[model samples]
Target chain A: MNRRAFLATTAAGAAVAAFPAILKAQGGDTIKVGFPGPTTGPFGALAKDQQQGASVAMEEINAKGGILGRRLEILFRDDQLKPAVGAQRTKELIENERCEFIVGGLAAHVQMAINEQTKKAGKLFISVSQSDEITARPDWGPLTFHEALNPTITSRAVGNWLAQNLGKKWWILYADYAWGKQNNAVLTEVLKRQGGVLLGSTPYPLGNPEFSAHLPKILAAKPEVLVTMTPGADNIAFLKQAISFGMKKEMKIAQPLHWLPQLKEGGPDLYADIYAGINFSWQLEDAIPEAKNYVALYRKKHNEPPGDYSAYAYSAIHEVARGITLAKVVNSDAVASALIANPVYNHYKGKQWWRACDHKAFQDLWIVKGRERSKMKGEWDFVDIVQKVAASEELDRSCKEKGFV
Target chain B: MAELTLATLAAQAFTGLVLGMILVLLAIGLSLIFGLMTVVNFAHGSLYMLGAYLGFFLIGYTKSFWLALVVAPLLVGALGFGIERFLVRPLYGRSIDDPLLLTFGLSLVMVETVRLIWGKIGLTLDPPRELAGAVNLGFTYFPLYRLFVIGVTVVVLVALFVFLEKTNVGLIIRAGSRDPLMVKALGFDLGRVWLLVFGIGTALAGLAGILAGPMRGVYAEMGVTIIIESFVVVVVGGMGSLVGAIVAGIAIGEVVSLTTLFAPKFAEIMVFIVMALVLLVRPSGLFGESGLME
Candidate 1:
């Protein structure tokens, strides 16, 4: 065929392929939400947990005669934990899948890329990843909402607890990345304010396989507390190597966040005695009625307790459904306004609210320690909640600081 | 700055030595495959990862690390033998890229299969009880398991050296790598030699994997990260040279470990920098037989 005929036939084929999807969207019986996650790579398990949580939420929502009388559907895409891939996935969700809203990002940097795409597409994005930049200054928009706790809150909560309880001498072992550096800085500030001495700080490249060389320096410094900011696979590798070197016996280990899935996988031997800040834990079911119900519901479908990221995704989907329910419309601005007007909602844990200033969710952050192997009640019972930092405006960046004043 | 005393330096060097040994195990396999067939075995890391997984399951079933160590490599070697026979044999006379690309695809399939079977979370394995804790050296406390890894590697390398340098089969294999046509002319089965060499190469990877499990946890994507570093070791050591693999692996390991002590941020980059500098000095690598153009 000639060039003109070839181009015309290809366009015709594309239009014919898109016709069925257009027909499907016109049915209006289901509401579509794009959920992009790092479904492959080191963080794959964590992302799988988030997808599992989304599955439970979808089931419950659809069971309740659906959101606004329409069945709720989540379209899952793998972002591969890459910023560019995340942007492309978000674009596909909006333009191709016709998802009205987007949710889920496991990595902090990748979430920003998703947010940028959502902003351009004028879609409501409920981010499940924790990044200070996602809700502050240049990136925050009317439709950008963050459900996960940022590094600031996590660092302050865990740092204060460690400084007051663990010891005065501190050493920070952090991954060299935007999120890791931000956590290190916040924790340092928190420690300094508590009259703690900074012994030393070591920043290793992300995905670094070994930590033994750095341990000698840490041991030599003899810091009372060793705070690590390694995430996902890096975290597992670091802790395993450090434990082999007997670093745990010498100093208290701590981190901004403890991934429950990792704790379950590593078991008590590797994770036990390491204190960390967390967004939510199933152990909260003891105190909160909603948490109990949520855990029970999740346990029926999955063998293990819902992870911290699972909680974020569960809350994001539920809150968005609630917003759509309140507004009785699928429009982004209307639902966003409805969500802002009604800030407080209880889905899994105690009360959590989306702050009106920057659409950043303010929720209780807990400090937890891994349970000893012998003390464990069940397979999933890996942590014991030590303290709960109540949700408060004081814990979040000020509205003025977020450039919203 | 944290004070780096003599003790600290000694401990860091030991750490480097341990890491280098692991690289040596991984790179030797890669070098052997390339030396024989001129096909870069991109799936070498996958074999290593599979070995770790097999070791994990074997230990769970048999409750013995020693048995798993022996059986896991054998299992991976068998798999490597099948891959060479079925997947790589047909592409023997084609462009080197044919088998290279095939192995790369094989790596992806193997990783996905692992994820399907084992799930995505990392699984930890403690070293044998005898090698669990740290040893109080004069300088600093070092993990006994790491010391054991170095010792085991030394013994394995020594045995490998003797076999390759002394035995008739080893001589035949070496001659085959140098000139397969001449080895065939002598009535030797070149195909079987190639298959055996590939199996041996992959078995080394499996052995390294099991050894690495206790130090770095086993997961599906564990192979992805280590593959690049192993490639660096193979290239810097001279693509097909066994001695080059050993020397370059240990040197790169020491560079990474020591750099972490003095300049933590430059540790990962230093490995590549060393490779670049070596290539600039010798385009065909340290012990390569032919120039790049040839």
Candidate 2:
């Protein structure tokens, strides 16, 4: 080929590479949403599910001709579950990608870091992780919207339910972290209200492999019910060690968000008869038609049932799309106003409405019990929901009393 | 406190035996490498993880757990051979810090590679049907697979001991550990012995991984946590002392198991505290030679 033709081809390729940037620079036509979370660490599975949920929502929205006729684009960056990385990635998303809104924060610390930036930038930030009432507090920022149920609400509901149904005496084993401390406080309040007494409480450092050291103290307490908030692989290790220590035979075990698929790694029989509180479950049929559809799609795509984090991300994206439509503009302030003012938005869990007091969305919580596969019909049918906790009852009074609004 | 009395102590002692078996498999390789070559194989845990994944894949493909159990270690040993010859040999005679740094970096690469291939979620490997359930120990129910691990490690340790004591290659290895210069002066190829020692050490790590695959779910980061505890075992037992490794492995295991009876939260810290006290008393380790400081 001649130099002229070659030069033309090279120039054409360069333009193709820079097309998206040029379009973005000319006018913010595309609505960009940033997903910053741990995509390659211990919590990578949770982060990946959240990202997938958001991706699915964006895909569905774009298929129907996106919000305000502009396609919604989601940019994912792995925060590695660190606050510093989350902050750095948030800044990059805002400055470089020029995202109009931000969504997805798997870790509590990451959410706090991103919240700091979003508050200053006046951008709408949707959190899909647990971080107690800190994120929901008005002092944190009006721009932040917690899509997931806060730990305070979750703990209170769990404690109250156990006290009323299971037993009045409780033994607590909590990770020594900010979320754990807040959860303990909330549980203590709820337990007191339900005429329950805290027998004993042991705090363990997060990711400690050996739980044998704390097992004796817990067993010695001899409470009717034992409650713990250690999540991830540590949960499996703790539960199995508890069984080895004969804690399972003595006292009933309760966990907040322990019925996840990660527990299956420990073994099918590890959490047998144990009760767990969860925000969402694929098994709940009457709750949302979208959940059933999500289960089917996720199974077809990944050959497995969609977990809570996946559903949360998927629903949060749809919610964000609704806000974008309401705003009708790709501006941060406009989107924030749309999210705040909007009420009774349709999510996978039927219709969810954000409580104005705490800026937390209200949804149904399920109490599930672990059962053996032989006792069940299918492979993923390990959990049987015992009760459905209504959204109104667990509205988190602390936020209301403190006037977070 | 009464719950953790003599009866509970006996129960935890059994639990410790199971845990120690796995640790011994891990520590033997670590001890052998340090003993013969004075090289700390930081990537030992990665090799163990690799063995588990290899065993999982092998079993899936071959439909034979026995084949996987045998083949995984060989594959790991081959890889160790390549690593020692190509990557590790050049760093010989250098500061001990170099191998530590190099192996640490190698571990990162191995972990990332595993993640890239298998993803971050852990995969389970079930034990053979004959050893799948728990065995009734009268006082406490023990997992059959864990018991199998203890049995396998005992057989392996005995075989290793006999080989080292009775075989010709074992004698050369022991002599080389004492003085490589003297062994080289005797017209024996110390280079080949070093290669074999490193390969066998890594192979033992792989064996531990395969045995543990059925217990601890095989994941990329499986090595990170296990490696730290293994180091503590090595330190407590005396670096490079095979007998020390065995005693320290079981001792640490018992400490962890029994501590959970009284103070479950401090069980992890208690193991390290014990190591610190051991170090204060004997800096070279419980079994390490005082004159052989690297």
Record all residue pairs in model 2 with backbone atoms less than 3 Å apart, i.e. clashing: A53-A314, A212-B260, A212-B264, A213-B260, A213-B263, A213-B264, A213-B265, A214-B263, A214-B264, A214-B265
| lDDT of each residue in A283-397, candidate 1, tens digit only | 8888999888878888899976788889889989998899999999987888899999998898998889888889889899889997889999988888889998888877767
Q: On a 0 to 100 scale, what is the lDDT of residue A396 in model 2?
A: 70
User: For each model, chain A TM-score?
Assistant: 0.92, 0.91
Give the 10-residue window scoring lowest on summed lDDT in candidate 2 chain A: A208-217
Chain A of model 2, TM-score against the native? 0.91
Q: What is the C-alpha lDDT of each candidate?
A: 0.90, 0.80
- lDDT tens digits, residues B14-116, model 1? 9999989999999999998889888899999999999999999999999999999999999999999999999999999898889989999999999989989
DockQ of candidate 1 compared with the true complex: 0.55
Q: Which lDDT value does model 2 have at B227?
A: 89
DockQ, each predicted model: 0.55, 0.24
Predicted candidate 2 versus true structure: per-residue lDDT over B108-174, tens digit per residue: 9999998888877777677788876565666655667777888899999999999899999999999
